[model samples]
Target: DTAVSQTPKYLVTQMGNDKSIKCEQNLGHDTMYWYKQDSKKFLKIMFSYNNKELIINETVPNRFSPKSPDKAHLNLHINSLELGDSAVYFCASSQVAGGLADTQYFGPGTRLTVL
Candidate 1:
């Protein structure tokens, strides 16, 4: 079973198209997240949701939205996808921090290319 899973390992589209990446965690984790790794390999936290607590990192664009219907799933929807939005999107999860550091487990990754 996949701890965290995302579909469409790769995506290619025009500059103004819209797309979405779906995520799910079978680990029964209470927290799930979305991260984007740019061409420079800089992994940045985009959005985090745990029990309805949504923590969004400021650097993420307004055109990007994260939807979490339950504790085990978080999906990312991009609007008016621009060339700059082209990057590797990763879905991650943690059991919820209570004692030690949270180790985010990542999915295979979805490479979105805006051509």
Candidate 2:
């Protein structure tokens, strides 16, 4: 079974459109993270949540929002998409021990293309 999964593996939308990506994890982890890989393949953390509580909010733009309905699910919504938003988004979950995150299981990334 896949530990972490994401819906709409591929998303193509216009520059001004909005879209969302759903993510779920069966690993029973307490912490989850969202990362964005730019065209250059530089992966950067966008957000992190622990026990359904927002923990880390990176320097990402306000157009990107991450919502965790529960510890097992996290979703990302992008509004007013732009060409610069074209990239791969990944969802990951990990256990927290000693105030640090343990091994993380990543989902099959969702590729976003903005025309």
Q: Pick the candidate with the highest TM-score.
A: 1
Residue pairs in collision within model 2: none
* Local accuracy by lDDT, each model: 0.87, 0.88
TM-score of 1: 0.93
lDDT string, candidate 1, 20-101, tens digits: 8999999988888888999999988888888888888898888999988777789999999898898999998988642227
Winner by lDDT: 2
Residues 1-115, model 2: lDDT tens digits:
9999999899999999989999999988888888999989998888888765675555799999888888899999999999999999999888872134378789999999999
How many steric overlaps does candidate 1 have?
0
